[model samples]
Target: MRRKQDKNIENKQREEETIPKKISYAEILELKKPDERKLFLRKTFLLIGLILFVLSIILFVFINTLVGLGLFLLSIWVISKYWTLQDHLLRESVYFHPKYQEFRETPTKKIQFFNFSFSRFIATVIMISLIIWNINTFGLELGHVGDTGHWWNLGALTWAYPLAIPLAILSLGLVGYIVIHPNLTIIYESENLYHIYEIRLFSPWLTEIPKNNIEAIRLHNSKNGPQWLYAVILFYIILLFKSGIALIEHPFQTNYIHSVHLIITASLTLLSIIILIAKQHCYFEIVTSDRLYEMWFDPALLHKRKMENIANFFCIEPIARDQHGFFDPLPKKSVNYDDQTRELLISTSRSYFRLCFGLFLIFIGIYSIFSYSLLGEFTAYTCLSYGFIVFFKGIKEDFSDKNNIIIEIDRENKQFKQKRIFSRILEYHFFNNLKSLQLHENTDKSPQYYPPKLDIFDIAGVIAIIFFIVQEYVYQIMVWAPKNIDFQNILVMLFELSIIITLIYLIIRPVDTINVGTKTIDNYIIQLPSLFRYSEKNGERNNFILSNVYKSKETKSFIKKRIILIIITISISAIIAVIDIFQFLP
Candidate 1:
């Protein structure tokens, strides 16, 4: 009986050792009601605070600068108090203490929610981005000209000075709103559910993932030590190379540029090297897959032991590692993707139409603006319209997330799917039914599987073509056409009609490339930036489906014509501008 009891005790200890550490943030915090109402109040306060802060800055610009400063400080103080109050409410909850990371353990000895706090990494990013984006604008507006006649807009006394206060408020408001939200990566209690809870102003955003569905947990460190160190060293070496060049080029010319470069490079080299990495901001991730999920994370966040326990608890197969002992970046498409199926991440697509149109509009706008209002009101209106057009188009291109397309190719199922982020539609096709995919470089946006759409740019092109045709026709009728009713007049009229038809064709060129009535198979067009850098080949852009399609003859022909047109148009307009006002810049 004693021996049996000892064996049972040993078994119990083994079971205890095997039991995975599961964290339940909600249960541990004893959160009862949905925090939506609470969050609503918090969001309202933040919005109001931001507006007031901006108002103070505006007041500062109009009134005395000191008055504006005082008001802004007051607004800032009020906002800070409100944030502190909001955090106080979060901390005062029954289970969670104000101190930080309070947790409650279950009877089974499972410790739930070791702790959750605001992410310092996120806060740091917000601060950095705000400073970088607004610095130039501030310099442009508020800065005074140097004694040597060097000028900048550095917020000196311009109306833009007021804008800085509001911008600061906006930045702080955003950081407070987002960074103060708790980070809950994974929380699980029983066999029934697993969840990731992020507390936001909207409420607790809880994504409950089923137990069997979770494939693997991997680590990603934002502050990659070795990579950062290498970059800093490379930057210093480049600076050193430049200094050497400067010494060779102007050995006796002492304007402080050479000395500045050398001093900065030398000062940073050692410090960047020996900051000996610590406290990484880590993101644990895995591709959302129906099969075994593959992920890689920093070992600091979830060590091998924790990974093994989690895998065992969830009944997941041990994540396979490559020969170098690193997790395989691309998970096998098959149970063993040896030969049956192949998955490829489609990377890099640029819209040549957008590019060409953007450049074309900017060219037109510059010419109109600098034409000295030669066409009077017509030139003024055109210049005004183009200003808005150029600004909006730039914002749409540079700031927008065009890389939200996710494609999945299931060779086993003979299926091709294109799914976009935040989109409900799943566009799919049969693999054998599809024939070709256009592969284009990032700089080469002319190649596309489908014809481009008709937009304002197309209309503008048509209008310009028509205007030129009209001008030519008027010139011919007044100067070249004989003042007699004869066969020549009929021929002239026919020529004008032909010009209209040609202009119409040019207007619809982008749209007419793809004939809807044709039975040709389409190549899936996936647009990305720096395609291979974040590709299935390198293993970074793992969330999307993958395929690498070589350039096709049909696509190539279309792209070649389109590119030649872009080039010719750009060259012609650029030459005109150079003659018209290359002085526009100087």
Candidate 2:
């Protein structure tokens, strides 16, 4: 009798442990009633649109150049009204599956979204053909630039062709990768494991996250919601400044016919800005403890109701959080850790990758700005502005808030990973935001304004940059003097210098442990950063080294793989940029 009772109790406990925290959908999903504020907004937009339309007509009869500005404002108002109405309708009722009425525990549920659109297919075909055509064109150009031809008299043409070949090849390679890549794949298994694969075309490579290592599954909106706003502001500021200058200089003497084109251009630019702002809110992300999976919506595809419906059907919990958006219906953790391990403060190695890349971009931008080509100046300005923004952001993070630290422990691999203090926001649009998840010691004190410490790798990078600049300066001076200078010695010296710097950096920045004296701390509230990190003390009575023995080989292997990938990417970009902007013939 006693044995049977004990078995029953054990089974009940296991069942309880398996069950997720129950949440009522009705309680969370509120049917928003028609409010006065919404009504006011609707009316206000309609009024503005009407007024703008009337004003545009008046302007068209008088100052034709001003008509376009009026029309653009009217169009914006109309679009805003449409969006507001759409949102209101979507909030009226919860669009949910009948299955959601009763939560059923399924062994596995997989949602695969394959975005093979007709337009994308057409684009891929065009790109492939263009690449082939360019490759052929480049070969001809290269032949023309040979000693037999007057390539020197061609000046910029000579340099442009040589630069074009590599750029074309790089583009072709990237396009091919994108065309073959899968859109998005999500698989949720009974073992609390999520298998997610998200591949976008512009991304250099596909990321296949290792299975069963997810500590937490969350869905959130991206943090880059404001960067788009900044871009729009800059666009308008430039536009207004140009328009004001033109008006002052020309006045009534402004040619109405010629100004029509300018108006059209301005109108299109405004429309684009609106679209850009709208698109910023279109992203929904599924963040694992380690990996982040993001998907962009057309806004037309799934309304708020439909999105929630999909979430509910998939057993996802809907969450509304500030800073970043997280979805609901979190899966139960596959592996459970002791309470003590969870309490450990974690930190990751501070990789100055973003800083270095930003500096490289600024350098390129400066070069382009000075190159004195119209197109170069415009492109350079954009790059310089963005570089400054990123550079400042890195500084802010390093100085102020270090919000991206999280405690990530992989029981399967017996490895712990954490992002650095000043990690870049993972929410990326153009390129893949891959962070090297390396574990490091966690500081016991609160985030402090510590003096900047230059790492060995940073010094190496600076030295390389100095060498390149010095070599370029010398070569340029020689070229301007109309003298034939042999660059073979300089090239060899630069190559040797680079090799030595790289070796020194590697030797100094080895995978060895550091012994910064440790201290014992009593129980304190631990808040995780936006990203992942896990720290374990190296001393005695360190009850913190989470339940499992740290396997150095596994951790080192993981770190090495990520480091190699980053190095390869940086090297390729640097090579292409250097070739593209070769200023002197030496």
Candidate 3:
């Protein structure tokens, strides 16, 4: 009877909810108004082209070759603007429709396939630069070094001719790619679906993923760095470019160290280029149960609003589930003095994967120091530091004794004495704490069962960032001055080391938890401890742990007030920022 009554209540509530208007097919296909800012940008671009063309002509007439070459870049910029404007118009026509959600379009929502991202532009520039370098280095020798020509006496250089020929051919191919790269950005979109064309100017082209086929959308941190191999590739590329330039400028005067550097650089650069050609950026992954589709995007484009818009059209939803089945509260395993009970000491054992990685890093560091490779030293220090942290985390969980957390039920004193691992002394608390255990619903973007503990995760993340900065600085110093150490460098190294120590302390610190009220003294009378005291008053003893998840009334109230103030401050700041940006825009 109660279940039936609840069903009736739910049905009534559903009926009372506001109904969305039924969308028609025609309405779904209808376009909305053009964005005012985009329209203004379109006109401004056209005006700039006219001005630049006239300016280019004047410069060509006044100055000779140097300034005339600038026109080529100016023309590309003008054409790129027209392409961008075309994309903005397409988005306005299809995406802005109010009823477009009814069409169920999949993501990739391509405005233009030919549209260039910042990374793409950077890649194109790198390719062009490399082609020029190759030409300067090997082009002339391979083209004219034959037995019948004035280069007939250059037969002594014949040993390198075979290798140079293939190298020159590869350079020519790279140049050809740049010429054709611009043509790949085709626009493909409709009211129902849209997709970006996967173009490979320097990298492998991704296969097209149809909108109707995608079963789910996965989000990633836009700021996450590229793969470790890719990072190594970038580092080597820099080294190669520097050495190659030095060789080209003064081939005969270069030292043995410079020669070795050039050879190593060239080999690494070739390997890196091959990797770049084979690897595609694994950004937004469109997942079906059976397959995955990966694509990269500008970080600014992956806004929450845009993601939600995509989700609405695709008829897809974010995956969130209680996969761990922690719905019921259970006591975590208690640690004891005996090593025989180590297996039951903690609910979960922290994996040693990171610790192993750290050890590998230490090996790399030792090798680097022996080889006098500064970059290797940086990698070693950073990795070893992180490795020891996770190693100790495992150690603490494995070896922690009962004294790590002491929960004393003092019946005569009508108090509880709680001592956690990191605390200097025990905290004395009166019994009479109230409220039942409460667990907040946790949802993460990744496929995780539980929310991460923010304290540890947040600190580790900050340390990683600091180490990255330190690593970069160390690399810079090694390149500029191998032996000299500046005061600033010493300070940075110290700071980096200090963070490692802090990480070790945090990782090994015993986690203290209880299953009672997180309330203050005022709400203590209404808490579960107060109810437990009733049994104590009747000459019975019950020992229990409290859940430390809830905030006290006073704390919650204070936090609420502060949050309101912060929201208002942020609102005012955002409005001011927007106005300032608009004022500077033409």
CA lDDT of each prediction against the hidden true structure? 0.38, 0.38, 0.38
Candidate 2 structure quality by residue, lDDT tens digits, 1-586: 9999999999999998577633233322221234566677777777777777777777777778576676967667685773545223112112323233322223355544444333223333543454454334333453345432322364224322432343354346546644664353333333333333334443322222223323222322223334333332333334433453464557564334323323433444334333333232334544433335555542233333433443443333312233322211111122233322222222233445346655655665556554543223444455444444445334433321243333333333333322222322222111111121222323331111111223433333333443443334443344432464457545544643453344234322332221111012111111122122222233111222222223335434644554564455446545545564574325
TM-scores of the models, in the order given = 0.30, 0.30, 0.28
Off by over 4 Å in 2: 1-220, 223-294, 298-341, 344-438, 441-475, 481-586
Error of 3 at 198 (Å): 10
Worst window of 10 by summed lDDT in candidate 1? 510-519
lDDT of 1 by residue, 1-586 (tens): 9999999999999998576545454543334233666667666767777887998889888877887788788778766755544322222212332135322221221212222223333433543453454344334333565321222243245322332343355346545644444333334444434444443343443333433233323332322322222222323333344453555457565455434434443343323322222223233443222322222232334433443344344333222222343322223221232344544443223334434444553454344434532222332233233333333333332122344433444445333333222111111112222232223233231222323333454445445444444444443454446565467656656754564464343332332111111013233233232223234355553222222222345544655665556446545644554444434535
Report the C-alpha lDDT of model 3 over 1-92, residue by residue, as the tens digit.
99999999999888754333233344433422355777777778878887777777777788765676597469558856865553222232
Error of 1 at 168 (Å): 22
Off by over 4 Å in 3: 1-117, 137-139, 142-215, 221-586
* Error in Å for residue 422 of model 3: 29
RMSD, one per candidate, in order = 17.0, 22.6, 26.2
The candidate 3 region of ten consecutive residues with least summed lDDT is: 525-534
